[model samples]
Target: MVKMFLDFVGDKFSASNPIPVPDNDPLDDCSAISHGTHVAGIIAANAIGISQPGFIPDVPFLGVAPEATLGAC
Candidate 1:
């Protein structure tokens, strides 16, 4: 499992002063381009009856922390 800590400094940090996060597009091929999405999936896939027919059986590809939250940086 991975843990993160976010610290806010300066007097500018306040409830009224929200940070602006710019919108971004996801990579077209998450599996091909980066392992980030795959790692995230491993940390959050539901593993509900999905399987690889030829390779494995019964056990689903569940994540370490299925209920964990996700965020982009």
Candidate 2:
């Protein structure tokens, strides 16, 4: 589902104004891109219960409910 959504967004947006693919090593020279920062901001900014994309990257701040039970599929 996530991949499909991303693909759709990429196809739609790329057709008009292409967004460059994220470099494999975005942090090698951090200043070269804002993708990392943008992702971090989104994850940290989510207030609702939705597990938005980039909602938790590292082990630190995992979201608003770090202790909530996450059931298996």
Candidate 3:
């Protein structure tokens, strides 16, 4: 049930995005290292029933609805 605002692109303000979010102000990029990507994973990432290296669980990692599909965006 989570939809992360990982990449924010607006004229006024950008939320530490990877690509350039053009505007009057600066890009305001982050150095936290894949923070947005991590959050994006939490929102809607799928495990694909694989065994990842770092995680202990069999599924490795999952979102709220890992294999679910939502018609509406």
Candidate 4:
């Protein structure tokens, strides 16, 4: 059941490839793509088998809901 959910969400919103932004301009030289990628990582970091320590000691840094689906506008 968990595997199915992961597969479905992964297929729908995998961030392995770069997603295009509507506007190519950045505000004050700040890249919107960079910000978006950071936010996305916070929302869905699938840390199922990672052994490295995350931002917090001993605890793996994972998203609020690793299996949750995500979409960018």
Candidate 5:
């Protein structure tokens, strides 16, 4: 579902993780675009794996409100 939404948006919403020079750390290509997804995950992720930037796989993203409904315009 995440991949589908990303593909559907195409260039409109860029979530490309880029590694920069010197520091050699990954940067959020578009934080504004990422913010919404992060918020949504916190609300209704429903047993999502923790592959996010700083999170550990063993500590997954258990939703704050797993039974919550989500909507978007």
Candidate 6:
């Protein structure tokens, strides 16, 4: 499901790839992808995960939106 969502975003949003810097570190690429991917993962992970809100059952995980839904301001 997460892969589907990422693919959908990749397809629908036709944006240029980040500029190709010479001798770029793989960590840089991971970091760049992580920035957005982490946000998306947090939002949809639980719903797609096995236990939902009860997954943690102890520790409090911060959600993508602890206040309101994410939408255009």
Best by TM-score: 1
Q: Model 2 — TM-score against the truth?
A: 0.23
TM-score (C-alpha, index-matched) for candidate 1: 0.43
Provide the lDDT at 34 for model 2: 74
Say which candidate scores most in lDDT.
1
Q: What would the TM-scores of all predictions be?
A: 0.43, 0.23, 0.38, 0.39, 0.36, 0.24
Q: How would you encode candidate 2's per-residue C-alpha lDDT over 1-73 as one tens digit per residue?
A: 1111122222223446776554333223344467755654544444544454765733344454444433211
lDDT of 3 by residue, 1-73 (tens): 4333333453434355546555443334454587756665677677767776777766556697666543212
Off by over 4 Å in 4: 1-33, 52-59
TM-score-based ranking, best first?
A: 1, 4, 3, 5, 6, 2
For every candidate in turn, the CA RMSD to the true structure comes to: 10.6, 12.5, 8.4, 12.1, 12.8, 10.8
Scored against the true structure, residue 65 in model 3 reaches a CA lDDT of 61
Off by over 4 Å in 1: 1-32
Name the candidate, 1 or 4, with the larger lDDT value.
1
Q: How would you encode candidate 4's per-residue C-alpha lDDT over 1-73 as one tens digit per residue?
A: 1221112222223366445333332222335568876887888887655666444445556798777766543
lDDT of 5: 0.52
What's the lDDT for candidate 3? Answer: 0.53
What C-alpha lDDT values do all the predictions have?
0.57, 0.40, 0.53, 0.52, 0.52, 0.39
**Clashes per prediction?**
0, 0, 0, 0, 0, 0
- Give the Cα error of residue 67 in candidate 6, in Å: 19
lDDT of 5 by residue, 1-73 (tens): 2221222332333346343233222232455566767888788876665466666666755678887666432
